[model samples]
Every structure is written in structure tokens, then in C-alpha cells.
Target chain A: MRCQQVRRAWLEPELSAKARRHMQACPACQREWELNRRLNEAFSGWEVERPLPAEWDRRLQQRIATARTGWRGWLESWRWRPHPQPLRLAAGALLLLLVAGAGLYVRPRWFSPRAVKPASTGIVRDLQALNQNQEILQCPLFAGHGAGDLANGAENMN
Target chain B: MVIEDRLTGRLKLSADVLDADAEQMLRFQAGDETAFEILVQRYRRPLSGYMDRMLQNSPVSDELTQEAFLRVYLSRRRYRPTARFSTWLYRIATRLALNYLRDHRHERRQLSLDQPSPVTERPPEAASPAPGQEGEMLADERCRRIRRSVAALPERQRTAVILHKYQEMDYRAIGETLQISVNATKSLLFRAYETLRRELRDLEEAR
Candidate 1:
């Protein structure tokens, strides 16, 4: 038989007249045909009335439920998490903290009224004490001279 | 409403929503988890049965069936509904089964029927004219031999035969499920049946 005829008959078994003749004459083809028919009959009756295992149903349900919950929970947690770029968020926070610390450190150097006021107060107190001491010493010296002058006038008058 | 009615309502509504194929899958793609469950529930048993027939091993079939459903659920976002939903679902299952069979190239070790035959278990469809006389020792032996012969066919042939014969899918549907041309699907079925017939020739001749 021509290969094209054989191939064509192979594709459309119902349409091929030559293939039917070939099967009748060819022992191999007849056996092949019988085998195909019998296997079809045998497998067509392959039935099992077994029920689905209850455990499998339970497992599938549990898995689906867990998946549902897990997906929702992940979405919820994602909402609370900072948006866009976490590295940028952390960098911004760090920048804010550094700026605040530098301000605290430099504030004393630039504008500490309390630090200057205490030193000025101590200098003023020391100056006032020294002037009082000088006045007391000078007052005794000047009074002694004036009293002697008055006594000298009284003696001259007498 | 009664509890049963309420549950039934829910199931019916769910089935309706699921029967909306591309729409339900779209919902799944949009992260509707219930849509995924509905898909899984609708598909699991039939797909499992198909896998069981293909693998001929219950545990492996069970695992592969679960994997197939999971893959479908996970890949719902990629669904285009280019063909029927069932064809797409079976395509996923067929790929998983084929991959597994490929990975485990060694012959599957099945429990030998070496011991004395268990009680005769006739297939349900074989309703003998006298139902009472049907469950005989000979029929059970035949079922065993036939089962062994089916298990022995090459994987593709076995799958094609089971899908065509047992699943009752026509050539186009089988081709859709197997991701092959209709002609290839028919050829696979033809070869499978031919192999099985040769294997069980004695049984047929005896009958």
C-alpha cells in the first residue's frame, strides 16, 4: 500500500476504503483492530463507586479557609506599614533626630542667658564688697585729721 | 429557612457563579478566595478519578490530583478561557501527571496479586442477566486480569484510553484535555486499545 494512502486512512479511519481492505488482508492490522475494540469495551466499564475520602474534603476546606485569612491579614498589616520607601522613612526619621540633637547642643553656646547671668552677678558682688572695705579704711583716716584740726582750733582759741 | 435549604441555597448560588467560568476565574484572579474553593470543589473528584485511572496507584493519584488543583488555583491569574473551563482544568491535571510520570521513570511497584484471589468483585456496569448469579469467582478473576493489563499499558496510551473510554470524552475533548491534535488523540486511543486487547486475549477468548 502507498504510504500516503496508509497515512490518509490512518487519519480518517472511517473514510478509508483501502484501510478496511488492508485490515482484512493484514493479520497484524486485524489483531490491532480487535485489540482496540476489546480495550475500549474493557475500559469503558472501568467504574469505581467509591466516595471521595472525607479527610480530603476537610483538608481542602481548611486550606482554602487558611489561605483566605492569610491573604486578608497580610493586606491589613501592609496597610499599617509605612508607605513607599521604608529606607527613605528611616532616613528622614534619623535626619530629624540629628537636627534636634544639634540644636540642643548649640543652644547653650549661642543663647544661654542663665549661664551669663550667674557670672555677672558674682563679679558685681565682689566689686561692691571691695568698695565697702576701702570706704571704711578711708573714713577712719579722714575723721582723725578733722578731729585734730578742731582740737587745734580750740587750743588756739584758749 | 431550614439549615439544609440555606446550605443548598448557598451551594446552588455558588455553582451558578462558578458555572460562569471566565467570570469566576476572573474573580479568582482578583483575589476572591471563595472563587478558588468553588473551582477546586467542582473539579477535585472528577480530576482525581482521571488521575487514579492514569496513575493506577491510589496515593500517587490523590497527591497529583491535589497538586493539579493547587496549580490551577495558583495560576488562575493566567487563565484566558481560550477553551472550555474543563479542558483547561484537565490540561493542568494532564501536565502534572505527565511530569510526575516522567520524573519517576522507574516502574510503579504495585501490590502483587500473588496470593489467593480475594472475593470476586464485579464491576458495577456488568449487570449479569441474573443479578444473583453475577458475582462469581470467574468474573472477579477477569476483573483482576483486566486491571493488571490496563496498568501495564504505556502511560500515554493508558491515559488516552481512559479519557476516551472511561471519561466518555469525544476525540476533540480528549485532544483538548491532552493538548494534542484530534488525530493524535484517536491514534493514542487506537494504540492503547490494541495493546490491551493483545494483553487480555486469553480472557476474551475464554469468555
Candidate 2:
């Protein structure tokens, strides 16, 4: 066996006869075998002592029981978000894209872009609400720091 | 015990214990709590050790091992006995470990590994490399280096190395857990060991 084949097969659970024969002669394969042996021994001898609270089993059972029920199950799961952020973000983005894509695909068939009026937008509704926020309008600092620009921007979006 | 994949109807030649584990899983799915307990009793320590090494966080690993089992419990009905129980369990454990790593990538793990423990629990080997105090010191240093070297590997590589080296998983089982092909598993182990060899060259030489 060539060194390449020998190196690749060295880590297998069982070595082939040819590879085993080759390993005996090759200095590099010898080092690899030694390192592998040492690593195995170290791992076998190693122990991780992580002490848990006495009630761990109880808490786990409670969590599992709670998880099997209704709304409490949802609440329990919300405590630990094990899913990765990128996947969540991608899913969110995909949903957004899907909604946008569906809207784009459906809009032209349902109503002409020019025919649909912009008066019903959520931004317009928000601007109407902002237009009615009494405390926001009454604040002195709201007037001092270009809060009018904010109001204007909201109005423009509307 | 023989398990045939429903989709293919091919015999799954897993070991007798693994087949037994699959049977236990099936029994748990059939509403046997004792079967699930059996599985838990068997896997808890190994999974805890695996998660601890993966995250380098002892408390979190313990907590997460419970969560992993809980996940298995929650998804019991959904589980098909198409795979070996251990492989499927490791798949869940690996995903949880990787997800934990991703979630806390910014935070430094509080490592509780390499604690001072007696390594002489087992009977001494006739070919034991170390026997006396000097050998013990050397052994300690070697172990420390090994841990650090393993910890320093890239995430997937670290996982593959740990699964292969520590878990003693065969390539097929590891590939299934990592959701990679067996060839890919071999390549991953190769790269990981190459990196380890580079890291521990001095230790190798000292030996």
C-alpha cells in the first residue's frame, strides 16, 4: 500500500492486512499509530466531573411533563432557543420573501399597480396614530430637536 | 433483534445491543416508560461526557444532556426505527452541541475539563508508558497538550475527532451522526488528526 492509502486506513476500526504490513515499516505511520494510541488512552482515562443540583432529575421530569401538555409546553420551550440564529434569520427572510413574492405575483393579476390607492397603507395608519399622540406632540424636547422632521417623515410615508 | 427499514425492507445489521436499543426505543414509543429509562441509564453518562468535551462546559453539558433526552422523549412518536438508536441519539447530541456552540460563539466557555483525577483506576498495563511520579507528570503534561490541541481544532473537525477518538465510533456511525458520507468522515478525521499531529509533534518526539 502506498503511504496515502496507509494513512487513510490507519484510523479505521480494523486495518487491512496490506495497510497493517505497511504501517510496521513506515516511520510516519508509526508516529500516527503511537499518537492514536496515546489519544485513546488519555480519552479513556479522562473524566469530566460536572456536578448538577440534586433536583436535576425532578426538574427534567417536570420539564418533560410540562412539554407534553398544552400552552405551558410552548412557554417551557421558549425558555431555551436551541435553534441557530442564522437558520431562524433565514427562515424569517424566506417567509418575508415568500410574502413579498406572492404579493408581487398576485398584485398584477388582482389589481393594477396604478389603480390601487396608497391611502390604506399601514404607515398611513401609523402616521394618523402618531398625528394623534398627544404627549409626543406636547413634549418640549420633541419640538426642540427636529421632531418635526420625524413627523414630516411619517407624514411622507403616509 | 433485526430491524428492517420500512422504506427499503433491508436488514439493518447493527450490533445486538444497538438492535436492543432500537427495540427499547420502540417500546418507549409504545408507552413503556421503563424502556425509555433503560435508554437513559445507558446513554446519560456517555452523552454527558460527549457534550462536556464538545462544549467544554460541564454544567451546561449536563443540563443539555438532559435536554437532549427530553428532546428524544418529546419526539418519541415521530422517531422511526430506521437507524440505530445510538446513531440517532448521537445525531441529536451533535446537533445540540453545535447549536450551543453557535448560540454562545461570542461567550467564552467555562471549562471544567482536565480536572485532577486518578488515572490509575484501571489495572496497570504491562506496556504502560508511565509508572512512577515522573511518568505521571509526563502523562499529565501529555494529556493537557492533547486536550488543548483537540480544543483548538475547528468546530466540525473537533467534533469528528472527538467522535472518532473518544467515542470510538466507527466511520459509518460517525458519518450518520454528522450527516456526512463515510468518505467525508474519513477526510474530516484525516484533516483533524493532521492538525493534531502538527500541534503535538513535540510530545510525539518526546515519546
Per-residue lDDT of model 2, residues A1-158, tens digit only: 88778878866668899998898889988977777677666665456654455777787788788777957455443343433367667876899999999999998988865655766888889888877886676787677556678888899999
Interface root-mean-square deviation, each candidate: 7.0, 5.5
Please, what are the lDDT tens digits per residue for candidate 1 over residues A46-125?
Answer: 56545567788676556545654687434533343323367757876899999999999998988866534445588899
Backbone clash pairs for candidate 2 read: none
Model 1, docking class: incorrect
In Å, residue B127's CA in model 2 sits off its true spot by 28
Q: Where does model 1 exceed 4 Å of error?
A: A1-37, A65-158, B1-20, B31-34, B103-107, B110-142, B205-207
- Please provide, for model 2 over B20-82, each residue's C-alpha lDDT reduced to its tens digit, 9 standing for 90 to 100: 888888778667898998998898878877887887666778788988999888777566666
TM-score of 2: 0.64
